[model samples]
Each structure stands twice: as C-alpha cells, then as structure tokens.
Target: MFISFEGIDGSGKSTQARLLAEMLRLQGHDVVLTREPGGSPGAEEIRRLVLEGDPDRWSAETEILLFTAARRDHMERTVLPALAAGKIVITDRFADSTRMYQGLSRGDLRGIVDQLHGLMIGREPDLTFVIDMDPAKGLARAKGRNGHEERFEDFGEGLQSRMREGFLALAREFSGRCRVVDGDRAPEVVAEEIAEIARKSLAWTQKA
Candidate 1:
C-alpha cells in the first residue's frame, strides 16, 4: 500500500510519515519511506533547484514543469519499484503539494496542474493524511527550521493560511483516499492517529 502525509509547512507531516514507516517496520512489514521532489537521485537534483532559491526563481508555469519532471523520475525510479515488490510506501508529500502551492503562488492553475498530473504522473496514494493546523501556529513551528528548503515556508502566514484551506478542500475532493488529521496535539497522539488510519487503509486496499 502507498500512503502520503501532507500539510502546510511545520505541520509535522514529515515526522508522522517517518513515525508511521518505523511503526510499520516494527510490525515486520517492508516499508519504504520517501519524499518528493527528491526521492530519486535525479529528482533530488530538481529538488535543490525548486526548494532552495529565490522565491521567484522560476515562472509558475516553469515551476510546474520542474515538479512534474521530478515526480515522474521519483515514481519511475523509486515508488513504482517498491510498490511492485509488495512494500508499504510512505511519503512526506506528493502531487497534492503542487496543486496547493502552485495554485496559491501562481493564481488559479488547478486545470493545468490536473492535466499535467494526469498526463505524466497518473497514480495516487492509497491513503493520504492531511495534518490540519492553524497557519500562524504552523509558521511558528517552521520558523525554527533552517535550510535552503525554506522557500515554501517563507511564504509567510498569509499564504500558509490559504494553503491550509486548499488542503482541506483537496481532502474533501479526494475523500475516498484522503483523511484530515488534527495536528494541534502532541506528536505521539498524532502519530498514533495516523498509524491507525494507515492500518485501516492498508487493510481496505489489500482487500480490494
């Protein structure tokens, strides 16, 4: 089964992704934990370009292409192979990030985003956890992090707020595969909730 965790910056999506992978590993499942736009070697190179730079480094349309290219590389080199081997794949983020981030930064571009995804990367995770939290609180948490990947987090609280709404909308739009998890609690609490959701989702996917 494949699972993804997503949310605005500092919503603990990465941490929960890692924790869920670890928990599944402890349960004796072969679990592969990865993230985009840097899962494969080639994708990692693209990741550096997209994540670490001036915010306006690429035109919004150009940025979309870069992200789609990275995702294609990641799926071909990492995601598809692992899934073929019957392993659990958990990722920190996925195509939904593009839908939200690009839509926010470049104006309404959902049509183009969906078209590019449908044309190139044509699969969705069996389950997705959107760690819902307040934008201001999420920004405060992200503030402590230091890295070149600060581009998205640097969008400030205003953008983060909009992205939060976008994610919630997406969760509803993809209700069959997405779950919104409250992210205001302790990490342990959040991890437990996600693990349980993954457990149920995994069972359902396997049965199907």
Candidate 2:
C-alpha cells in the first residue's frame, strides 16, 4: 500500500505520517516512510535547491520542472523498488504539493502540472490523508520551526489559506483516494482516527 500525507505546512501531517508508519511497523508490516521532494539521493540534492533561497530563485515554471525531475528520480530509485518488495510506502508529500504550490498557488498552471505528472510521473497514492486545519494555526506551527526548508512556509498565511482550500477541493475531486482529517484536536486523538482509517484501508486492500 502507498499512502501520502497532505495539508498546509505545520498542519502536523508530517508527525501523523511518522506515527502511522511506526504503528504499522510495530504491527509487523514492512513499511517505508519517506518524503518528497527528497527521498532518493538525487532528489535530496534537488530538494535543497528548491526548498531554500529567495522566493524568486526560480520562476514558477522552472521550479515545477525541477520538482518533476526529483519526483521521477524518486519513483525510479526508491518508491518503485519498495512497492515491488511489498512494503507499505508512506510519503509526507507527493505530486499533490506541486499541484497546490505551483499550479494553484502561483497561477493557473494546474494544466501544465497535471500534464507533466501524466507524462513523467503517472502514479497517485492509494490513500492520501489531508490534515485539515486553520491557516492561522498552521502558520504559527510552521513559524516555530527553523530550517532551510522554510521557503514554502515563508509564503505566509494568505498563501497557506489558499493552499488549504486547494487541498480540500482536491480531496473532493479525488474523493475515493483522499480523506480529510480535522487537525485541531490533540495529536493522540488525531492519530487514533487516522489509525482507524488506515486499518480499514489495509483490510480493504487485502480483500481486493
């Protein structure tokens, strides 16, 4: 099974993703927990370029291509091999990030993003957990972190709010594979809910 966690930065999706991976591991599942735009080595190098520097370091178009390249490398080197080994792959972010950041955030480049994804990286997670939360709270949580990856977080609350809406719209558009989990509650409570969903998804997949 391949799963992804999505939402505005600091929605605690990353934490939830780790928790879920650990839970699955403890349950004796062969699980791979990873993140993008940096899973494989080649992708990690690209990640530094895209996640740091000035907001205008690269034009929106250039950034999209870079992300696509990284994703392709990740799929070829890391994700595919693990899936072939029958491991449960849980990623912190995926192509959906580009759809929101480059396609929806910057402008109406969603067509380009989708076309690129279809052409180069044509796979979606079996399940995507969107940790929905208030933009203000999410931004506050993001601001508490210090990292070179602050580029997207630096986009500030307005962009994050729009991003939240975009993700929700996407969840609706791909309702079969996306689930929205309210993230304002305690982490333990949120994790429990996600675990339940994960259990059901695992069972369903096994039956199929």
Best by lDDT: 2
The all-Cα superposition gives candidate 1 an RMSD in Å to the true structure of: 1.0
Error of 1 at 156 (Å): 1.1
Look at candidate 2 and give me any clashing residue pairs.
none
Candidate 1 lDDT over 28-81, as tens digits, reads 999999998889999999999999877778777888899999999999999999
Candidate lDDT (C-alpha), each: 0.90, 0.95
Per-prediction TM-score to the true structure, in the order listed: 0.97, 0.98
Best by TM-score: 2
Worst 10 residues of 2 by lDDT: 146-155
Q: Candidate 2 residues 1-208, lDDT tens each? A: 9999999988999999999998999999999999999999999999999999787788889989999999999999999999999999999999999999999898899999999999999999999999999999999998888777888888789999999999999999999999999999999999999999999999999999
